[model samples]
Target: MAKRIVIEHCSGCDKHSWGTKHDEAKYSSLAMNIASDIEGEASVRNIKLEVEINPPLDRKRFVPKKSESLQHVYFDKEKKKDIRYPRLGAFEIHYVEGTSVAKVLFSKIEAHRFPSRHDVTSALERIGLYSPAKDEEEGRYMDGDDTHRSSSERSSHNEDFTAVRMDFLTKYVSPLGYEGEEEVKKMTVGPPRAPTPEPEPEPEPEAKPDEKAEEKAEEKAEEKA
Candidate 1:
């Protein structure tokens, strides 16, 4: 857990903005941790955030895909294993130095690659990440289909690259839902972490007793006059 975290974002690096437009809060949450010590300054050329979110699962099922015209996802009767979520938490980004992120922090910190869209929420929750937005922006998370609708899937079983394929298997192939995947063992992930938000600076001290009384006496005499 980080008592204080700084995103130290770089316009030079491309991965920070993985998807979507007009959304920085989504990415800021990536840089944020559990620590409330999130107050700080950065060399950021600009700062913006997106409080976008994916909606609560409707508990839909993966029915056979219709033709291109009918390939939309809908709520059906197949029940996915009920997944327990953690207590809610806050999420945001901090601006820090680029060199600090690449050299000092990233390698030492453990990271997890979400195998599926389903896995994204779990991993984020496990790590204390939250949706910056609560209302309309909820459930707007983009998935494999959202990112790639050009090539249709023969089966919902295999799609996207290695990560997506692994995720699909975790959902369909494994008896134990996502938690019961073999790839999970191979993945060396970090423990639950919450970086502190920036700490508020300590306030300046009050004036001395003499200074306070002297100012008060002056006001009193002025009022009398």
Candidate 2:
């Protein structure tokens, strides 16, 4: 049970030629809070916050491979759960100061003793790491088979190696439709908290008129008479 979130459209950026992109929305809000002072007095205060929301990723064009073509489902040994995925191969690469090391896993590795660099690259492409247009620009093409540019020419374009495997797991291979998963926690955002009320200060005693001095003056005048 999540609280219903609300968003208001932003009009301030309409004048810019490159307005808000299709992938994102912009908003402006003037949020205020009731704050308390040291003497327990309440006052209105202004607060500033920035929030960004990413809609769900689209997978409309995603076509799962055939059962026979898919590799062994990824298994989490610590959690003792099998992650069913359609891709045949998966890999991870680590870069350190212009040097890189690749770790790949292929369930059906009958053709070779160990995975080669080309094999790892092909796997990476399947997991959405390599762009075909970019490859073509670099004198590389993917035919029906696994023939592509040399690893030396292509490796330089890939800056973040860890993102490839992470995208493969979370964006593509991640499971949908939580079946046997734990219940989702509830979130509720209620109204702002009220501040403590401080009592007003007591009024000072009013000054009394100089009645004693006037009486003394009257007695002196009577004694003179």
Candidate 3:
């Protein structure tokens, strides 16, 4: 597969479809993106954006703009979403699309004109994705000032709301399934009598860097000799 850098799957970026630009054979466009929060723990940030490359005026580098889909997922101002590290990576509640992008159903995120930590948290919490709190504080999300944030806020024990929704997809929704092929073949009855499947032969390793260089030097020496 060809490799290409893509800023997709980044919450604040715009969605770039491979309608005509798709080059699976020559270039496998990057499907996933890298995201992180203020603490920089690779947390998912919900940025309602699509990918829009700014044609280079100088042709040196192209910067992509975060264009709006013109959607909005607002939260109650009284909810107080001024905290850091939203509960879930990004939104995973109710995808507004008539159908889901993947097999998993995700919550729709309405974009803000400018998504600050405050605005993003508000939207995330609206879809039940803000960072988790005590079970007793179900109604509340977090403090506005980010003062009471935990030292382990990066890896908080809060319920991963997005994962909870995905659990349904993995257990029953996906055709591939969580179990193996043999497990899938059997449903109610046991097939324990079946012998263990043979492991697939590994592909030959790539030529080592040092060996290649030595071979090149030997070839040169042979020509000189």
Candidate 4:
């Protein structure tokens, strides 16, 4: 199956502080590292980094402007101070085998740890891009929990939360990877079986005329005798 990895930039960062040297370097490094990791993966067929040059305004929060330029303005407090919006700086990993796509959105705290190649690989592993068992080990190491737990148990506890986040993001963001509807299998119905035929009635036997004639002749002969 083919894999596609998308590294998305923060729209708020681009709109507000794109020209700033610090912001430029931050996003650039993030994009470069993600692209490198995706390209390094043999399973990845396509790698793309999409920046929101013209992000939509549907979710824009209107706040009173501090300056007198306007009474109210669209405000993104999270992205105003170089922090990514809750949904921004996300990675969308798609697999051709399944309809559902895996999504990862890095918090401000997490983004700081993503500069290294190891962190990039670890990020992919967390989003289920690599071996699941290996990912579990890495998760344990990262969490600093040495207790040995069964795969199912760990997955139920850890992976289940990831699944819930995936569900929430997919429902809210509804990324391009998940736009198409899943193909539904069609079921065929056969014609009903023909009913059984009924049996025919038996015909009645015809009486013999010779037996009547013999009886008459015998009666006449007895009368003459």
Candidate 5:
């Protein structure tokens, strides 16, 4: 059935809505019609409709000031500066919204060790990115008397981390660039199952004495008598 409703304009966002900014009468009427439509559609589809009004933002990329809940602060020793990064969990929570990549990444990741965002970040630090501090002691040392760290020491540390990142990217991520639909289908399906063991053969029973033959000989003897 056709339904008519007015779309009200908002001064703050310059957006039209059937929600908060709308006239109270229009808002109520709109809510009823929308709810009715959703209920009918949900019944037809055998699914429930959850309508959220003015849902809170899960993550915000930029803010007037820094908040721990919003971003992560990391110090970059080489640059002699602090870097701001999205908290991995918050980043993924934002990234997964309205994206096909979520399913692809999730399905692929399910077969691997990176279940939690922390695990994924750890994996990335080990093989995806070159983190400044390898351990707590080195990090503290770098913040203090880093001048004592020799040129060779810095070079060796960077080289090792860079080698790990490059090797993993080259050996694994780069090759994935060539993956087509079939390859992706296989990858997303999950790890292969182990082979099933064959069933053992049943043993044959031992032969029994010929009781039928003995009965027949006795019958023949009785008949002759």
Candidate 6:
């Protein structure tokens, strides 16, 4: 069966786009795994893999395609304006076997949950296909820090690529409808913000020994008189 996997790398702050061809062997392996998983008991042989890469966009942030769902939207209540966000980087893996077609999504999240397929996620991380927004966040913390390194240097770090895979097989690809497909996995945007620390209590002032002594003396004198 011949399969085509389209890895779409959307534009990020870096304004660069990448495709599956960058790492053909890795993508091929991924395709095989997906095929086997989808086929189940059925035999899969003589599989052909094709990868298509999309060009980078000029703008940092752009509206998502109609088919792609928006993960988050920032609305300014005070300004009464919508805060535009940069377009997120993503990967669209399409698996086609004859007339049947299946699709999946690797979306960039602010804080991506651990992917269901560690191998798939690791494969993507091995390459430079990651979210630029995540890179920027790490860069902010990396500044003046000795423990952290640049995004390029951390290519092998699976912890950095916080992207979730949207399994389209359930809703879009399955011929039997969404009954048998696994539930879609959810990815968190970022870590929860730390709570504000409460203020410390003020120290109590100490009484002066001189003032006490003076009061005592005055009292004694009054009693004597």
By lDDT, the best candidate is: 4
Root-mean-square deviation of every model: 25.4, 25.1, 23.6, 19.5, 23.1, 19.1
Top candidate, metric TM-score: 4
TM-score per candidate, in order?
A: 0.17, 0.17, 0.19, 0.30, 0.19, 0.25
lDDT of 2 at 85: 32
Tens-digit lDDT track of model 6 for 1-225: 655444443333233334411333333344444444434311122224554444232233433343233322334455555543322433344333444545454432422321134333334334423333654565521211122455565433334222322342322223222232333322323454588999998888986579888999999999999
Q: What is the C-alpha local distance difference test score of each model?
A: 0.32, 0.31, 0.30, 0.40, 0.34, 0.38
Q: What C-alpha root-mean-square deviation, in Å, does candidate 3 show against the real structure?
A: 23.6
Candidate 2: give the clashing pairs.
none
Give candidate 3's total backbone clashes.
19
Model 6, stretches more than 4 Å misplaced?
9-50, 55-91, 98-205, 211-224
| Candidate 5 deviant stretches above 4 angstroms | 1-115, 118-130, 133-201, 212-225
Which model is ahead, 5 or 6, in terms of TM-score?
6
TM-score winner between candidates 1 and 4 = 4
TM-score of candidate 4 against the unseen true structure = 0.30
User: Which residue pairs in candidate 5 have backbone atoms (N, alpha carbon, C) closer than 3 angstroms, thus clashing?
Assistant: none
Score candidate 2 by lDDT. Answer: 0.31
* Residue-by-residue lDDT tens digits, candidate 4, 7-83: 44443344443453234344544555446534645333233333222233334433334654332244655456322
What does the lDDT read for residue 71 in candidate 5?
36
Per-candidate clashes come to 26, 0, 19, 0, 0, 5
